[model samples]
Target chain A: MSEGSQGLLLAGVGGQGVILASMIVADALMRAGHDVKQSEVHGMAQRGGSVFSHIRWGERVDSPLVPLGSAEVLAAFEWAEAVRWVEYVRDGGAVVADVRTIVPPGACNDHRSWLRRYPGIDGELFDSRHLKTRLIDATATAEELGNVRAANSVILGTVAAFIDIDNKHWEAAIAHLVPKGTEEINLAAFRIGRDVAEARVPQTAPDPEGFSGPHQIEINHVWCKGCDICSRVCPEYCLAVDVDGKLTIIDAEACTGCKLCEALCPDFAIEISAPREPAVVGNQAAADGSTL
Target chain B: MTDVKTYLREWAMPHVLCPGCAHGIVLRSFLNAVDQLQIDQDKLAMVAGIGCSSRLVGYVDFCTLHGTHGRAPAFATGLKLARPDLKVVVVTGDGDALAIGGNHLIHAARRNIDITVLLLNNSIYGMTGGQAAPTTPEGALASTTPAGNTEPNFDACKLLMGAGASFVARVLAANPMDMTKVMADGLDHPGFSFIEVISDCPEYFGRYNKVGGGAEMLTWMSVRDEGVAGPLAEKRFVNHIPIESVPSGMETGVLQREIRPVYAGVRKVEDHES
Candidate 1:
């Protein structure tokens, strides 16, 4: 009930694990001895639709709702969703948003060519003078790391770093809350997010192409969702993900040009080019596409 | 794990269902039935309304869809009529099917449309913080009914049969094998098949009424005898019809399997009789 209590809002499209991530955060906060109150909305129009969770924590909390313009944190799962709900962030509050953009189907319902008329989303929507922002390409990062679904965990990690909670409690909550077999990956994502926040570094995974061989695979950085399936399934052990979570070819020659990476990519970002003469490493000049 | 993984959308695992919610059990049982039946995933259409149980459609990797709250039957009816080739199945929770959807439920059965409806009856409105629902046991405690639910609750299986469904069965979440068997029977039935999954809502209903958590409720359900649908079981459930008229001996496994003409895509006898 205190005026200076902590309040956070988690917003994302449905099937994005909004409720689960919020629950994990609530658990961590409650274990840290803070009174936590959480409210959520679940229903029929959820699949691919907008969803949100409201969490409040402090010495003593009253209502679960954070009231307009009073939240300390606005953790969003997509870039556009951050813009849609950035109004709730209190002055000086931080917005931790995933850089992915998901345009609702209704927005483009009428016209197949609406993008030409409307152009694209503004990348600087959350860059207001008053509000602090930490945007992460969590989907790409998690996917590139082997699981695009870990974006929620990665975002939670990033959010946890900005908050005052200790690492021990967060770990405990994640271990208890996350389903079996995903603890390590989620924990790694949490740590990566924490490191990004603590270091205040812009995420840029060093060029994925480390070593070159007779066969070359170029990954369009913009299009990759960063689910690490390619790296995990790669027989060559030549692929490695960078800190930025954009996939990079760590060992090029090690790749047998198996085309497995290209086959497994959900985003179709990997292109296996038959042994190029000059193996161009990092700094993808032709990398700008829809993948980002 | 392999068996379920084939049916489940694994990415959506550790579903939104609460810790002790029995909806998960019923969901697994249904999927097991699908696996046992060797159903072609592409030829199957899964429809659901709003509730915890309805969300099961999301996890099933099939031609699954979600309709508006309490309108799944109508949507399923439309799907069945238009694309009779698809094996249409409807999943709904207590509030969704019985309260707002009571109209569609009766009509779907009356028409004998070929659709399998798995009504997960958790007594209270589990999604809406446990308000009293049409299927909540009379005198049962709920958040809305502080003093206890005063109104009677309808037995969905009986009501579906009374509405002229060709196949009807009542099973519990605690008994997965029986639930799966009955579910398979319902699915294989030519006409409208209705299976009532007596579910548990430990968070809202149990916490309010002091019954117990999900495990305890499952234990209670497990010990109860099946196939003994005599006056004792009849007394527990509420029906609009008289007790004398209500059939005793609801033989549990598959209560009804009558050979009736299906309504959908069926020609009238008078039109073809020579």
Candidate 2:
């Protein structure tokens, strides 16, 4: 996966639809012929605490979680929380923050007033662009859309246009997730955000399918134990052991495409293969028991 | 004896649980019920609390969740609320249910949400090395109750029945035959069904009580109440052992009542204004 296609993070205080926004991005990625993994912290969010969701996608994804400092873009629904999760973004990554600061339970009697004077949060720690932040009046946009509930969806639209994901995939995902009767307001919110994001970064290019990122696994053969334990642990059983118990990957085609073997290999002797479009069944084997 | 191997998740190893523990029996009965019902395997959510009995989900397939101690009821409650169409089952031991999760269980029954709660009762706590539990017999010896347990045990069936559970019953794990029926009935019944399995904790309860072994314990349980030993017995029996052999309706277990409060205590607020 390309650094741009590892996907984005969505963060906010409670009640904001950070989870829903992440889901929307995941669905869009899926529709664009990429594998996507989305994870959210559920039970704790209702108590008025910061909420964040990790959205990771690629031609292939090994885990739902994104390691910190890998997010290509961040859609921060709250100012303070934006600062809190800014570390998720990579250096030079973009942040589309909603300027409306929500008062966490004990901030002050006049949190709204304090927020107006709440000097901007720094973004350099994650190597992200500080001055390039897009301040969106998402609440105001939702109000104009006739319902404040559509704010997250509006923010997602802006995120879509800023990232490489296709706008149609985002729209399709909205259609799939939203309840039967609430399509119009959601689509409207999506359009508002998409337009905002597009307006901010006019030169950004849309991400194409099968984009490869710089992250790659390197093998050190000198450290190899040759115990063949990695072959025994492979879930896809992609490993083959010879009479001497030396390990070798057999029919890498049989690999369910999970890197568990590589990750768990005792001797860091297994390396990641070059980026190639994952093969569909037709070319690999015949329909019946016979090999192609 | 239902084979648990077929229903268990392929990767789940039988590494946990104690020997002669009734948790295995309850878990087997639950898997049998799911199999018989032809439930959508993917949609079945099994939530568990902390205890020897609660660890049973590690051996089951489907979406198994191991939550905090005594919080399976609350966690299952939230899961059921979020996805009403899914079949949600909460499995917890006596300590997990009666001690820490008592409020959540009672409120869950009061609400009568469409969920099943299988409460495994082994007289004493087995996970933390057999301390005196709420369901421990008054004279039972435990690690914490060196002399003997002074307090009375809580009849969980009575509590749930009083709280308006649509279905409530109790069965013993020694009687695998009856356990299958009881568990099946609990899973099929709508609203909140509370089924308490009088499970065994041989390493703890047996050694403390000097009950030779699980077989001896089963024999003792079988012979305790022979007065109700009749055809189509008016009382519940496990493995033909009348564990709770008192007359129906007069007993604490085997209760079926009308629905009351449901999920998260969120009644149909006339408007969405709450």
Q: For this target, which candidate reaches the highest DockQ against the unseen true structure?
A: 2
Ten-residue segment with the worst summed lDDT in candidate 2 chain B? B228-237
The CA-based lDDT of model 1 is what? 0.73
TM-score of chain A of 1: 0.64
Considering only the true interface residues, what is the Cα RMSD of candidate 2 after superposition? 18.0
For TM-score, the strongest prediction is 1
Question: What 10-residue stretch in candidate 1 chain A is worst by lDDT?
Answer: A198-207
Question: How many Å off is the CA of A238 in candidate 1?
Answer: 42
TM-score of chain A considered alone, across all candidate predictions: 0.64, 0.60
The per-candidate count of clashes, in order, stands at 18, 12
Q: Write the per-residue lDDT of candidate 1 for residues B73-192, one digit (tens) a residue.
A: 899989888887889999998788888889999899898888899999888998878899998777888889999788978878778878888888888775677787889888887778
Badly placed stretches (over 4 Å) of model 1 are: A1-292, B223-251, B266-274
C-alpha RMSD values across all candidates: 24.4, 24.5
Quote each prediction's TM-score.
0.44, 0.43
Q: Best-fitting candidate, measured by lDDT? A: 1
Which residue runs of candidate 2 sit more than 4 Å off their true CA positions?
A1-292, B1-4, B224-253, B257-274
